[model samples]
Target: MLQHQDHLALRLALIANKRATVVRLRDERRIDDTVLRRLQATLDSEEVRLSGGAAVE
Candidate 1:
């Protein structure tokens, strides 16, 4: 069972990481459509997990 504040913190971290990845992808000129799509998917899933938006892990 995760606390709400802790969960929010986790979510923030996930967002920060995703942002970093996006920056890296952009900087490396590797931000292809497929890669962006996959990153979006992963970010969405992580948000769900952080929000208790999914079934128990």
Candidate 2:
């Protein structure tokens, strides 16, 4: 049973945040590889938690 929806909401929020960050960085005419990697790592980590340690993709 999926009791709490926090994880799902957090995942959505992270996606929105990543989108915003990408747009901002793009408009600034510079992409920070470190920042992008960090965001991706955070997303992947959260997804792993959601999937109960199952492989993502």
Candidate 3:
């Protein structure tokens, strides 16, 4: 399991990725729930692996 600090770090990493993706995609002026959900799911999977299956609130 990931320590609390590690979990926090993972969350921060995911947030950074999301923000970067948003900025990169913003010029398209198009976004959908499916896209956002996919991004979130990808992050969640990473977090689960990084945290040893335990997710932080």
Candidate 4:
């Protein structure tokens, strides 16, 4: 449905934003292992959501 697509799009956008933040932090040498792990966990969860074909919201 259109609403589901919109939700997917929003989730994708959020993932992109988080990825960019991670990149920015890495570039600035401000990302610690704990932060990296957290981000990785979040990305993994998002990946699962996408793979499961579930709506984000």
Candidate 5:
């Protein structure tokens, strides 16, 4: 159970990091709005999936 929690935490952290990175890239104009939106949606799905089909925010 603890290990599962640890893995979940790690995955959440990674998703968060990816989100921040994506936003940063968008702000820097390295990624276009369409790509940003698509990636963000994908990340959102991943986060919700990790949270057992519920969104965190």
Candidate 6:
């Protein structure tokens, strides 16, 4: 269970990093609004799952 919790934390951190990178890319015009929205939604969903106490795969 502790390992599972650690995995979840790591997943959250990775998702957050990816989200930040996407935002930076979008700001620099490397990615469009559509991609940004999609990425944001994915990140939000993962966050919801973690916050809801769902186990990480």
Find the candidate with the highest lDDT and give its number: 5
Ranking by lDDT: 5, 6, 4, 1, 2, 3
Model 5 regions more than 4 Å off: none
lDDT score for candidate 5 against the true structure: 0.96
Error of 6 at 12 (Å): 0.4
Flag the better candidate by TM-score, 1 or 5: 5
Candidate with more favorable, higher TM-score: 1 or 2: 1
Score candidate 4 by TM-score against the native: 0.66
| Ten residues in sequence with the least summed lDDT for candidate 6 | 48-57
Residue 20 displacement (Å), model 4: 1.4
Higher-lDDT candidate of 3 and 5: 5
- What TM-score would every model get versus the actual structure? 0.55, 0.51, 0.51, 0.66, 0.94, 0.79
lDDT of 4 by residue, 1-57 (tens): 999989877887878788788978977889976787789688868866775865444
Q: CA lDDT of 35 in candidate 6?
A: 96
lDDT of 1 by residue, 5-32 (tens): 9879877687878867886896788887
Q: Write the per-residue lDDT of candidate 3 for residues 1-57, one digit (tens) a residue.
A: 468888778676877688568656654657666676777677667667766787555
Task: Write the residue-wise lDDT of candidate 2 on 1-57 in tens digits.
Answer: 254577676676777687678758856868776776676777767777876898866
For all predictions, the C-alpha RMSD in Å is: 5.2, 3.5, 4.8, 4.3, 0.7, 4.2
Q: Model 1 reaches what TM-score against the true structure?
A: 0.55
Judged by TM-score relative to the true structure, which candidate is superior, 2 or 5? 5
In candidate 2, residue 39 scores what lDDT? 67
Considering summed lDDT, which 10 consecutive residues are worst modelled in model 1? Answer: 48-57
TM-score of the candidate numbered 5?
0.94
Pairs with backbone N, CA or C atoms under 3 Å apart (clashes), candidate 1: none
For model 3, the superposed segments whose C-alpha errors exceed 4 Å read 1-29
After superposition, candidate 4 runs with Cα above 4 Å error: 53-57
Candidate 2, superposed: residue stretches over 4 Å from native: 1-30
Candidate 6 at 8: error in angstroms? Answer: 0.7
Candidate 6 residues lying further than 4 Å off, grouped into runs, are: 53-57
